[model samples]
Target: MTDPVDLFVIGGGVNGAGIARDAAGRGLSVILCEKDDLAQGTSSRSGKLVHGGLRYLEYYEFRLVREALIEREVLLNAAPHIIWPMRFVLPHSPDDRPAWLVRLGLFFYDHLGGRRKLPGTRTLDLRRDPEGAPIKDAYSKGFEYSDCWVDDARLVVLNAVDAAARGAEVLTRTACVSARRDGGLWRIEMRDGATGAMRTVTARALVNAAGPWVTDIIGRVTGTNSARNVRLVKGSHLIVQKFWDGPQAYLVQNTDKRVIFINPYEDDKALIGTTDIPYDGAPEKVVADEDEIAYLLAAVNRYFKVQLRSDDVLESFSGVRPLYDDGQGNPSAVTRDYVFDLDTGGGGEGGDGAPLLNVFGGKITTFRKLAEHALDRLGGRFPAMGNAWTSGAPLPGGDLPGADVPAFLNTLRTEYPWLPRKLAGHYTRLYGTRTREILGNAADLGDLGRQFGPLLFEAEAKFLRRTEWATCAEDVLRRRTKHALHMTKAERAAFADWFDNAAASHRREAAS
Candidate 1:
């Protein structure tokens, strides 16, 4: 059967979802297929920042630095609820780079891209400044710079949601198993991972955006070859209770010339991470090894007065970055910029044919621009498509009056006075203007239905299922929300059981 879509995108990571959203908005019929749930890959497992690679200044990545730096504020305005400006405290290590160089980098970072709303960098006297209280007394000097924090997984979901809202099809738990050029169109077969069912789709073009699985999709799934290669760099993060005061994050420079981020997470906890190690194994089986965790904890312990121990680790996760192999031997030195390989039908398709664009190596901060550039790469195919419109558009509920989130939160506090303070704040921070849709006409706590745990109320679960396409309990607890991190093990199990039964019963009723 002939396919109806103009584009068939493989993967539901940020890059795929963003591309699908951009293409769909440009008047192209699009269908995005993910092997697992949205952000069940590296997209969710990021450092969760939208910053210009501050350290990349050393590598002379001026282009990447400027683009990403500009994207920081653009994304903050686009999704105020999921992305926000953050200040980072970098304690001076005279043993490492000199203070003059650090100041120079910070100066470039401050003025690189039109930074209008976010604050500029400032030097600190660690011995006197309140920001230096948490650091060890050994360090008496530091610098503070600005970046933006992001809900990485939610960023993917918002793109997919906006794509769907613009009439694009987003099929989670669907894997593109095969692709072949048939006539001028591309034939793609997708398998539903949950049901063992298969379906075929036809599209004018196909996009490979499987992140760590990009090369896998190109060779194993698409049965095509490219001169380019993907280097799988394994990175990991550890979560623990917040050990420091204030909202400011810490960027600690390692003796290895690498930097580790210690950022506040989920209100009461801190998110620390990332070791760059080359990996030859499967991406799905990647996990944080003892050495990696020890390394991270050691890095933090080196800078902070309060040393982090193995016992402090509440959780940990690992991801493989599908970096485009530029023949760089060092994993840390590999380029983070993406490369697009378009196959215009040279092999078994006879001579010339439909385009197959394969995206490689990108960061969460640059996904939007990456998507726009991906479409620009396909400009030859669809010259009639609309111009770039995403730079100014808000994602989902980010369209607050004047983009003023503080004012909006104040208004929400007055409107939902009956709601518990923590719960109300959580809803305001996560849902933004869409909080009303979830709360609806609820009068009190009783109107919210059964409360499974501290914050996993039935009302929120129902909203997730109905609006966010959350079918499984883990999707709601882990990705759609962070309730799993806060909920007890027993609480999580009970909520899982409740969600499973509710979904099954609802489906049964719908069929009847």
Candidate 2:
């Protein structure tokens, strides 16, 4: 066992990592444990957009939409490299929401939450505008709005990195087998996935930000009960080649009244998704079904001149959103807003017992705020804890001058003339100013070690494993970085083989 800390966070997703970072920065001791790699779950498998959820306005979630809209600019200012503005062209459908209603929503979207830095919504002429060229002429009008694109997986990793830098213990591939309250402190037991070794930790309070497994942690792990419940909603997406010519993305309303986003992804590809379905299966076992794939393709086909078929789906992924059950029957109707269930001793905040904070239904755009609110709930326990500090601070590597990505990229290239333009661009997008840490003093491409693909290099892999807690090949290929999406099957297999060997050798050396 070890000395008791101020907080113990159970999940390593965005919310959990964000909470860990926030608490640690507040002068509170914290330990954050994850069963798998950071963002190995729903955090990585998102539509990769940080938006205000324009459709939510129809549900009268003005507070949620306004908060999200405000956060959109805050996050973009915070992480300019990974989170930057993107234009979305919404092709109007006469059959669905009327043009007047659409215009009203855009008006509210522009004015709500004090919009700043991003362009306001504009009307598009589908018959003449360049953005509408890809649309079938049947739709003669559309609207364009601004939102931000994000590297969903990298966002989670950066939070974990910042938490560690702030003196918080981040354990990846380590599962919290059990956590129970004992004598006013919570005793937590964790088992390492690789060694099967168990370690005990005691914390003054616990946070169950377990995402899909929130209830599991409450009942099965902590042996406690809660009145709250989470409704599992499955959302799926498909990846295809960028079929049109433009930086702008497309938003089309389907016959079912749900909006589909077809966004430009990875320069040469497109990311189209997300089907909302009531999910009852295991969150880990979730996968995009054929029906969902067809549905997404059909939605795109309805507006675009380019015909998309099921075969055009290069990849598909699904994430089970643990939405707070709001007595809504439709999966899409469920509120994306978050809720907190704090369990202090005897159901009161002033009690001296260790508190367990359970987070429900939070999205990427509002993670920072969620963390601040979560900590505020436990202010009675720690009077000496510092005030909320994440809103003004930049995340790891997010401290760019003027939050300018283009200028930073140019500067990086000027400093390292040997770095290829594409490689430099990738490094800047993923690591921002921290690209120096990955490149080091080595002056040329040869110094980057072996080249796995155009973007995947041996030095970058080592950096991830060393600093970012990358345990296996997928951690780098899929989450910490997205080199897997660009490489061939054989190349991926070869890299995996090399990575496994390297990891085994490192283990042997450590044991010696």
Candidate with the greatest TM-score versus the true structure: 2
List ranges where model 1 is wrong by over 4 Å: 347-352
For residue 242, what is the lDDT in candidate 2?
99
Query: What are the TM-scores, per candidate, against the unseen true structure?
Result: 0.98, 0.99
Provide the global lDDT of candidate 1 against the true structure.
0.90
C-alpha RMSD by candidate, in order? 1.6, 0.8
Q: Which ranges in model 2 have alpha carbons more than 4 Å from their true place?
A: none
- Tens digits of lDDT, candidate 1, 246-361: 99999999999899999999989999989999999989899999999999999999989998789999999999899989898888889998899988888432335788999999
List model 2 lDDT by residue over 220-258, tens digit each: 999888899999989999999999998999888999999
Best prediction by lDDT: 2
